[model samples]
Target chain A: MSTRLDFFIDRMVSQRACLDFGIAQTADMQGPVFELGLGNGRTYHHMQHNIKGRDLYVFERAVASHPDSTPPEELTILGDVRETLPAALTRFGATASLIHADLGGHNRAKNDAFAQLISPLVEPLLAVGGLMVSSDRMYFEALTEMPLPPEAVEGRCFIYRRDS
Target chain B: MSTRLDFFIDRMVSQRACLDFGIAQTADMQGPVFELGLGNGRTYHHMQHNIKGRDLYVFERAVASHPDSTPPEELTILGDVRETLPAALTRFGATASLIHADLGGHNRAKNDAFAQLISPLVEPLLAVGGLMVSSDRMYFEALTEMPLPPEAVEGRCFIYRRDS
Candidate 1:
C-alpha cells in the first residue's frame, strides 16, 4: 500500500545505503569507480566527496547537473553508455571497484529492456569483490547478488558483487 | 509527508537490511551474536537463519514470541536486560561480534531514557569492529556511526561500529 512518494523515498534511501556500503567494502581495493547515468550528478557528487584514493568516472550522454555537482571534463565521458561502457573496457580493463547505475525511468517496459542491454556491458567492468549498485534488477552472467544493507528496501535497490 | 504505514515499512526494511549487513560483516569475527530485545522474536528468527559460525544469545525478561520464533532455553537468558546484560559481561566477556537491539517503544521520552540507560551497558559487550544495530539513536562515547544503506530511512534505524 505504498504511494509513489513512498516508493521514491525508498529508492533514494536504498541508493544511499548501498553506495555507502560499497564504498566501505571496496576501500582496500585498487580501481577506478564508474557512475552510469549521472542525472543531475547527485550520486556522482556523493561519490566525489566520499570516495578516496580512487578516480571516479561518470558515463553520460551530456552534462546537466547542479553547478557544484558536475564532474570535471577529464573525468566525464560524454557519450551513450552502450558505446562508452564497452570502449571503457579497452581503456580501463575490468578493474572498476564500484559501478553504480540508475538509468531507468518510470516506464517499466523500457527499464527492463535497458537493464538487459547493459547488464552484460556492466558485468565485465567489475574487479573481483567489486560491488555494483543499481536501481533496476540487472541480468548478469557471473556476478552474484550481494545482500542489501539494513536501510535498503528490497527491490528498490540492488547490489551485486564480482567474485571472479 | 509519510503516513504511519510508511514509517512502519521503513522500520521493517531498515531493520532487515542492517541485520543482514551486520551478520555478513561479522562473519569472520570471533565471538557470539546478541539480540538485546527479542520482541516477538522476528529479528531473532532472522539472525538464527542468516548468522553462521557464531552462537546467538537472546536477552529478554520473558518469552512471548510466536512458537516458530522462540529461542531455546540455554541460549535465551530469561531476565531483564538491565540485570542480565551486565551479567553477560562476566559470562561471555567483551567479545560479541554483533548486537541488535529494538528496546524502545513509541513514546519519545521513554525511548530516549531507555536508550540512554542501555547504551552504556551495550557498549562494553562488542568486540572491536563489531556492529551494533538499534531501533533508536544511542549515545556512545567510542562507537562511531556507520553510514546507512540506500534503503534505510535516516533516523529510523541506526548502525554503530565499535572500532577499538
Candidate 2:
C-alpha cells in the first residue's frame, strides 16, 4: 500500500479497532464475510485467521504483496473486480453475506462509480442477514445537520439485508 | 412536532426511501421501527399506518404537535436527546437495531452533537447483527483524486481492514 493508502487504511483500522472493542463488549460474531478490493493480503490474513472457517473471498485489482502468503484454497485474488467479480462468483458458486468495501479515498468520482458498480453485486452476494461495511467519509464530507442528534459518521458501513 | 421537525423528518424519510431503492433495494414495509427525532408527527402519520408498529420519539426543544393524535403507547416525547436518550432506552426496554438520522440542514452544531451522542449507542442498541444505514452525502462533499485507479479503492477497504 502507498503512503496515502496506508494512511487511509490506518484510519480504517482504528475504526475497526473501535468496532472490535464494541463487538467484543457485545460479543456477537456471526458473519459469513466477503471483502472487496483486498490489497497485498494483509486484512485477508487477519480475518481468515480471526474468523476461522467463516468463508472468505478476496477480490483485488492487482496482486502485489503476499500473493503466495494467502491460503491458496480459501483465498481468491482477481485482477479486476469490475470484470472478474461476476466470473469469480460463478466459479466459486457462492455470493458473500458480508461485503466490506474500503475503496473510497481522495477520488470522489471513482469512489461513487465504484460504489454504483458493486452495488448491483451486493444484492445478489449479500445473504439475507448479511451487512456491507464502508466508511461514511467515502460517501459525504459531513453528516447532515438538520436531523439533530446526528448518527454514526466515521467508518460508516451500510448493512443491507435481502429481506427487512 | 413543529414545522421545523416535520421538515426534518420529511427529509429523513426521503433519504430512507432512496436507500430502499438505490441502495438496499428492499421493498418497504410496516414494522415496529423507531424514528429518533419524530418532528411534528407529520412524517409519523405518513408512515405510521404503513409500518406495523410505529414508534416515534421526539427530543425537540419545544412542544411536539398532535400529541393527542400520537398513539400514547407508541409515541414518546422528550425535551432533549442528551438528557433523555438513556432514559428513553430504558423506558422503551429495547435498543433500536435499525436507526435513521439525517444529521444535516439548519442545525449543524446540534446535528454534529447528536451524531456524537448516538455514535456510542449504535453498537449497544443495534441487534447483534442489525444494520445502521445513512446517506453518503452526509460525509463527503466529493471524492478525492488518488494515484491509483478507481478499482484501487476497493482493495483499500480490505487492506485497511487487515492493517488496522
Candidate 3:
C-alpha cells in the first residue's frame, strides 16, 4: 500500500501534469480560465505564469493564500462555489477555456459526494474544446472524460473535454 | 521512502504522461516519431493510437515483443541503438518531432552512464520545438529541460524540448 506521502505527491504531480496539458491544448482558444477553489492559490499562481493574455477568475469563500500567490480582488469571486459557480455561468456564459478544481476535503466519501454535487454546476461553464481538470472524478453530462496525460495517476487527477 | 512498487508505478505513469504531452505539442509539427526501445512495444502501441499522420520508427536490436505489439519490418530499424541512432541522424537529418527513449537496465549507475552516452546522439535529431522524452536524465548541449507536468514524479520521467 502506498503511504500518505505518496498519495499527496501523486495528487500534486498529477495536478501539475494535467493542468499543463490543458493549458497547452487551450493556448489558441479564446476564453478566460477559471479556478474553482483558491486554497493556497498554488495552482492559480502556476497558471498565471504559464498562461498569457487571458483573464483568470478565482472562486473561493475567502482569501487565505500566501501573499505572493493571491489572486487580485477584481478577479476573485468570493462565496461558496455552489453559489458562485452558477453566478459565474450567468456573468461569463459558457466560455471558460479551462476550469480547474481541487475543492475536496480529506475524507474520500465526502469528497466524492461533493464532486457529484458540483459536477453539473461546473459542466456548463466549459466552452466547446475547453478542458476541465479536477482532483476528483466529476460527473458531467456533456464533457467527455479525456485520457490522462502520461505521469498522471489514474484516479488522482481527471481531465474532461467539452467536444461539442 | 517509497516502495519498489511505488517507484515502478511512478516511472510508468510519468512515461505515459510525458509521451502524451510530447505528442500533443508536436501534433502540428512536420516530422516522424522515433521510439528508441521497443521492449514489449507497450509504449509504441500507445503512441500509435494517439499519434495521427506521422510515421513512427522503432529502434531495436531484435524483435522480442508480443506479436500483437510488434512493428512491421519496414518501420523497425534493427541493430543496437548506439549504432542505429547515429545512422538515423544521417538518414533522417534533424527532423524528428518526438523521440522517446527508455533504454536503461535495472542498474542505476549503468542507466545513468547509458543516458550520458546516448544524450549527445539524441540531441541532434530533434527538430526545433520537438520534444525528447526519456526515462533517464540526459546531458544535452542545446535542448532545454522542461518542467514536468503535474502528477509526473520528479526525476522519474524527463522531457527536453529543442527551443531553437
Candidate number with the higher lDDT (1 or 3): 3
DockQ of each: 0.02, 0.01, 0.02
Query: B50 in model 2: Cα distance from truth in Å?
Result: 53
For model 3, residues B124-150, the per-residue Cα lDDT tens digits are 999989999999999999999999888
- The better candidate by TM-score, 1 or 2, is 1
TM-score of candidate 1 versus the correct structure, residues matched by position? 0.51
Query: Model 1: per-residue lDDT, tens digit, B1-164?
Result: 34333455578778877877888889999799999888767788888888877899999887897676788999999898999989999898889999999887667799999999989999999999899999899999999999988867788889999998
Model 2 lDDT tens row, B38-156: 54454344334433343434344354545533545435554555556566566654444344443333445765665566555432433322333432122211212112222222211
lDDT tens per residue, model 3, A1-164 = 34333455578779888988999999998799999888866787788878888899999998897666788889999999989998998998999999999998767899999999999999999998999999999999988899999978899999999999
Per-model C-alpha RMSD: 15.6, 22.5, 15.9
Ranking by lDDT: 3, 1, 2
DockQ of 3: 0.02
> Against the unseen true structure, what C-alpha lDDT does each candidate score?
0.87, 0.43, 0.87
Give lDDT: candidate 3, residue A128: 89
Deviation of model 2 at A20, angstroms: 3.9
Per-residue accuracy of model 1 over A30-85 as CA lDDT, tens digit each: 89999998886667777788889999999999788767678888999999999999
